[model samples]
Target: MNIHAAILWEQGAPLSVEEAELEGPRAGEVLIEVKAAGVCRSDLHPARGDWPTRTPLVLGHEGAGIVREVGEG
Candidate 1:
């Protein structure tokens, strides 16, 4: 699925908003149609380079969404 996401291209850099392709749910997983998203302190920790992570990361974990599909076991 193609969706809009805030992507981190590099450490200590602001996230860039763009379209991203997502894989379908795997075993024991579900796909969500996101309704809301938020940036918390934890998000900032990595965004501001306070902590190190691999490049090209996706941000925003605090959010609300509806389950759209479920994967088979």
Candidate 2:
């Protein structure tokens, strides 16, 4: 499945809204449909190189969403 996500490909650069491929959930995993997200300093840290975070990271730790899919039990 493909889902729209904000990808930070570079530091101090704007996030790109792109369609990312989803490999689905593995065992004891679940998929969420994000309805709302929060904007915090942590998210900007990686975007501005304030934190030594990896590139091409998905920035969404503070958010609210719904469960869409679940992995096999």
Return the TM-score for candidate 2, rounded to 2 decimals: 0.85
lDDT tens per residue, model 2, 2-72: 88888989988998999989898899999888899876887888788988887888886988889989999
- lDDT values for all models: 0.90, 0.87
Candidate 2 Cα misplacement greater than 4 A, ranges: none
Which pairs of residues collide in model 1? none
Give the candidate number with the greatest lDDT.
1
State the RMSD for candidate 2: 1.3
What value of lDDT does candidate 2 attain over all alpha carbons? 0.87
Q: How many backbone clashes does candidate 2 have?
A: 0
User: Model 1 RMSD to the real structure?
Assistant: 0.9
Prediction 1 global C-alpha lDDT? 0.90
